[model samples]
Target: MVRVGIPRALLFYQYFPMWHAFFRALGAEVVTTPATTRATLAAGAARVVAETCLPVKIYCGHVLDLVGKADVVFVPSLRSLERDAHHCAKLLGLPDLVRAVVPEAPDVLDVDVDLEKGTLAFYRAIYAVGRRFTWNPLRVKRAAAIAWAAHLRYLDWLQRGAGEAEHDSETGWLNDWHRGLTNVAPLPITIAVVGHAYNLFDAYACHDVLRRLASLGVAVRTPTELPASATRAAIARLVGRAYWACEAELIGAAGCFLDDPAVDALVAVIAFGCAPDSVMMDVVQRYARATGKPVLMLPIDEHTGTAGVATRLEAFVDLLTRR
Candidate 1:
């Protein structure tokens, strides 16, 4: 059996189940780089220049970790997931970037996913990737169908407020959210967290911030719980239109939180060096201030200390509780 490695950074958080199902349907054994760690971040940073963003650095680390463990690594270049708007440049050229830095990385199976060309282009790209593993187009199509089903189930899971059920330790809060449906006292504080999914959910990347909030018995709301219509309305009202596809997670979520009476405050997590986020976060902050919502902007980088993030989160929650 051929082992195919998929990094746990970037698109992994967004589309991992689909990726896993598609590859497995093709009969490829799949392995993923474990959760981010100091060592993972260090290995990734060593391969890239200092200017690269932390998420991209961690991606490089994941690819490096897969060097000897897999026959090929799946690294797709996603130019756009929606029309007109596009992904960050780093994500668009990720295959080349990872290959350039992580020279020891195993052979890579890459495909271009540009929805601007049309939604069909997205499906065709996955088919192209499946072809590398097997010649049977029929098998590829079946894999696509199975992958689609998995994607839908994953979305439904997200809507329930529990993140991926796959992890129990670090994401226990994610797994525990359903108990709220059963009947539980609401936490005193309800905070809305807005950021790139990678930065928000990647435990090590954000120093397990959400789990920390959960440990405090705080009820946390995230972009995953938002409705598409609300995000679109927020985009329309905030900036006329979204400059980046992922703005729904940041600007849209923040916009919704500002209007929501239940949410006590807003937290924005952004990685340093992401130009779009820096600019968009500025807009969010200005709007948040005008609306009287206490907002905390946490900037992370390779040198970000765990203690620092913990202290800041504690302080932010403290401020919210006192109000």
Candidate 2:
């Protein structure tokens, strides 16, 4: 049986089910890298350029992890998910980056997902990926349908407060989310965490920021929990449209949080040295300052120690709780 490897970093948290379902539907064995760990970070950091963002470094480690385990690794080049929005340059060049960094790894399947070209362009990319498994167009269509359905269902599940789990994988991340939501302590403070899905949900990247906040008796709201209409309404308040796709989401979500009376403050979790995030953080900080709301911007890199992060979180929680 053919095996396809997927890295669990970056966009995997957002679209793992779709990828998993698509491969399984086509009778391909799906293998994924383990959750991010200290060793994983170290290994990835050794090969990545010092200037690259932490997520990219972690992703590189994952790709290398699958070197001998699978016949081909999937690293799609994501240019744009919508007509008006484009991704970070790093994401747009991820496939080539991985190939360059891990030349010894097995074949990598590079698929382009640029919806700016047209809707059909996006489908064609998926079709091309599906063709690697089977030549029959009908089978490919069925796989694509299953993938789309799984993606929709995953989104719905997150909205329903079901928390997120890599479909059919070990349940640690999902369990952590649920435990945070159901904490026994009274959560009198509500904080909106605004960032890309990869940053907000990845435990290692943020050093379990969600659980830390919940333990401090604070309720955390992420962009994934917001309604599309609400996000759109928030985006309309911006002076101009954002160019980067993830930055746009953060901007919209930050606006919503700043405008909401129920939310006590805003926390932006970003990767250190990320140019797009640096720009978005400036926008968020200005809006927050003008509105007289407290916003904490936490930037993490490979060198960030968990102890320092915990101390900052503790201090921030104390300040918010007293306010």
User: Please, what is the TM-score per model?
Assistant: 0.92, 0.94
lDDT of 2 at 200: 73
Q: Once model 2 is optimally superposed onto the true structure by TM-score, how far is the C-alpha of residue 264 displaced, in angstroms?
A: 0.2
Best by lDDT: 1
lDDT at 164, model 1: 45
Q: 117 in model 2: Cα distance from truth in Å? A: 1.0
lDDT, model 2: 0.82
What is the Cα root-mean-square deviation between model 1 and the actual structure? 2.9
Could you give candidate 1's per-residue lDDT for residues 118-227 as a string of tens digits?
87877788788988889888999999999889888766767666644454432333354333332225778888888988888788898877777766677877787777
Give lDDT: candidate 1, residue 252.
89
